[model samples]
Target chain A: MPEVSFVESLRMTLREEMQKDPLVMLIGEDIGRYGGIFGVTKGLLEEFGPYRVRNTPISESAIIGSALGAAMTGIRTIAEIMYIDFTTCAMDQIVNQVAKIRYMSGGKMKIPLVIRTQCGGGRGNAAQHSQSLEALFFHIPGLKVVMPSTPYDARGLLKASIHDDNPVIFIEHKLLYATKGYVPEEEYIIPLGQAEIKKKGREVTIITFSYMVWKTLRAAQQLEKEGVDVEVVDLRTLYPLDLETILQSVRKTNRALIVHEGCRRNGIGAEIACRIQEEAFDYLDAPVERVAAMDVPIPYSEPLEKAVIPDEEDIIQGVKRVLSRN
Target chain B: MKEDHQIWLELYRMMVKIRRFETLTGELFAAGKIPGFIHLSIGQEASSVGVCSTLRPEDYITTTHRGHGHVIAKGGDVKRMFAELMGRSTGYCKGKGGSMHIADFSLGILGANGVVAGGFPIIVGAGLSIKLRGTDQVAVCFFGDGASNRGPFHEALNMASIWKLPILFVCENNQFASTTSFHYSTSVKSVAQRSIAYGIPGRSVDGNDILEVREAALEAVERARKGEGPTLIENRTYRLRGHFEGDPQRYRTKEEVENFLEKDPIKRFQEFLKNEKILNEEMDRQIWQAIDSELTDAIRFAEKSPYPQPMEALRDLYAEDVDPLFQRSLA
Candidate 1:
């Protein structure tokens, strides 16, 4: 199998889905002839026709609302918000309509809708376009959150999310689009709510997901060089989090450090920390340390951005602190 | 609009069904058997029945908070609708959607929306799908005078007009949006007047007269099916009941309600049918008996149905394919 970039994988998944299901459709701003801001949807309008790959007006509420309506009426729709920050404009539709419809309707309704948006601050997109909001979605009960860290997982998960019966909030990292991983050209699926253990270790376990997964893995490699042998766990799905896997890892290592790109205050790390403290506290040798981006907006300046966001060195330091505490 | 014997008789049957359904629903709400707020389509039944009667079974409809009458006219199952209001597992939305949001997709009654003007954009999307699939299906959106001001309503109508989407926007101007009279709320004298801005044909009809409402809705739907874009039908009617079950009509007068009731759609239909010699006592009795039994049975089914399990609440928020989904993906 040839290595495929994450962006290419997403494009292929969309192509395959569009070809298979006549009801499958795409809608977003500049998604038609413009091929999307990221070019992941290049040539879709020409290949599938404009109707199937529509370019919607710049109305997030309408974009999300229309997608909800279309999905309710038998069209399997994938609506894209250009950036994660803009989803705030459509919070009511996303949280109330999309998240609550199935439960509020007693499961008689199916919203086969996928809302794909990008998150990250490395490019100095600053506060508006850079914050990770997976925790906010994870707080909602009905929505499933997918944040893939690799090209293989991104492609496989996008295909799976498209066909899933529920509404999926798929978050793509701005930094990972160009990243490449070995992906089969043919059909595949990466199951949601399953964590992948990136590097096996007997020392403290590092529970992380999304763009921070790679950061922690690099940190783990450095930790191993220092004889710490830190285990790095990547949680592929955030909503129905694989608590069992995380618990098992914690039981084995008896020490842990949770990491996320989202700000630390009331972030996903807090929830994961609370869960660990509850389920595996007796087995742990030290309190769980969390390595998250400091609780603030991502800055425009490179050094300021680095200070606010967590990197491999920060993950390495977090591991050392957890090990010393043990 | 004067109707012949047959049309009057049909109108009487529909109006009675709507009136009886709402009366029963109001009673259920008072009895605490129904959860969530109820927006009755009581006095405005003519608008729902009239326009819905014009639609083919395959043609689509999107409705508003006050949606029961429209659903009934579009052939939704009465028992399932009731069951849904009671939060039973057998309801139209499997007990998820209550009074304000009941729907039966098989009958082409897309779910009634809770948000003001929320149905417009969705109706446009549905219309787009219809056009794309090369189906002659025309989608009708029955909203209220209040929804005319919503941004989505304007966006949807403009897009529909430009694309010539097969849609009929039926604005049931029932005078008040929860006690806020249209006169005080809307800037335009007539809701249909707004259509000129979108470049779609516009018309106003006596919503109290089912025949008039039917004729207008039908003409607009026909035009849409002919690939002529959307039409705005402002059916001027009045709200017979308070906005929801518990609203005290401190905003309106008893004289106003009485005045609207004198021209009640059901009574009007009955008079028209009797004068035209189409209504017999036997036909009246049969229609009442049929609707009554349906209502009674539907209530029973809803009462007997189970409440949803707590765990099932986790399902259906997102579409899924081969992935194990949130549990595994997060793991």
Candidate 2:
């Protein structure tokens, strides 16, 4: 096994998929020669050439709509919207066209497309470039949402997403791109909607995903020294949420703490917390606590941005609050 | 520029078919046989028929909300289209998508979009698919003057030009965006003029003249198939009917509507055929009678077809098996 950065794992997976299937291609702005804004597609243009790795204009609507069209026409396309926040510019295409085409067409058409975009804030890119909008896409049907926390999960899940017959919104955390993780050299796939236990404990269950998964894990490690055991569940796929794993964890631990970087109001955590309470009402020893970003536009200053988004301290506090009931 | 009599006759027949079908559709909607509001292209027959006549069955096309003419010209089955509008199980979308969303993938009709300018970017992708597959087939996009001002229109044109993709953008400048005239809404004088900003060949034609529209379409289609990239042709025409069914004509005067009706493409094409000695009163009557009988059969088919089962609403949401939760509930 070799260690690889999250972005490197993505590039390696893209290269492998493109080589394995001719129908798989990429279309985005500055992806070809510029190798992508996040460098996730650094050498793909040179390796795959311009035909397969297409650089489109600064047109988010066309970028996504064209990908939807191409996918319907028998090409599996991976389109990159530079940032998830910019996805608002092409909301109609994503919400109305891509998400509803299969259903509206009565399954006569299949849109095998993956919209890859970066989300999260930690480098002070401000509100525009940094937003965790998984909640928006997860709300729509006919779309599969995947957010990977590790390079191994990123490579495996993206490979699975490329082969999926439906439309997928593959979200990458900008802060996690450079983080290194152990990835297998052999070809493998981690099926979507499967949760991975980063750390096992029985005192409390901390269910999170994306960059927040790492924060929760670090907090769990810190809590171990204080004799408080915490189980951290990384939800790799958000839409077809692996509630089975979440419910089981809650049933055993009897306490649930859902953490995410998105705002708490109507966030993904709210939905998960509701489900946990609904299914494991008898097992829960306390109410499900949620620690999410404050409901405000992320500020440009580093200190203010850090203050707004949830950190390891927030996760630790949330865990202690939930464990206090027992 | 001598025209082939047989081709001219066929074009005339298609134009008449489109005209008669739309007229009957308007009646059906008025009688409450159709469920949703429909946008008719009653006066823009020549542009749709003329352009589509030059396309191969393998080529693809994307249409606007007012897309009945385009569907018919592209060889869509009239019975299925009627069934679609009637919300029957036999429709192209199995009643899920009504008039503005009918699609026939087998005939390469990408779809009819309800959103203005939605087809612009979609056609660009179709063109790119053609290029990647190494096919010479072209993609045609039918949009109105209102769609020309949209962001996707500019993005698609620019992308198509830089990539040298095979696409033909046919802008039906019908002089109205709902109630606002193109003259008031659009900054440029002609929709074709905007194409020059993207460095593509652009031309304007008298859309009511079937021959001119066909000739322009032929040139553009040829350029696309040869990998010469996209061309924008603005078909200067008029909307004979209100924007949609039940649209009060308070926005425009009755006199203005009468002036546009005078240049109805079907009527002009009939006169052109007669002047060329290819059609006479007898031939014209025979054509109208055949179209009437065909439309009668289509209406019957729609009326007789059953509505989709209520349970079918849950089906077709995903090609793969949906989560067991949805499956169990639907089951």
What C-alpha lDDT, on a 0 to 100 scale, does residue B291 get in candidate 2? Answer: 92
* A82 Cα displacement, candidate 1 (Å): 0.5
lDDT of 1 by residue, B197-237 (tens): 98989999999888899899889888888887889898999
Candidate maximizing lDDT: 2
What DockQ does each prediction reach against the true complex? 0.40, 0.69
| Candidate 2, Cα interface RMSD | 1.4
Residue B228 error, candidate 2, Å: 0.7
After TM-score superposition, the amount by which residue A160's alpha carbon in candidate 2 deviates from its true location, in angstroms, is: 0.9
Model 2 CAPRI rating: medium
Model 1, B205: alpha-carbon shift in Å? 2.2
lDDT of 2 at B220: 96
For candidate 1, the per-residue lDDT at A269 reads: 86
What lDDT does candidate 1 reach at residue B87?
Answer: 80
Worst 10 residues of 2 chain B by lDDT: B322-331
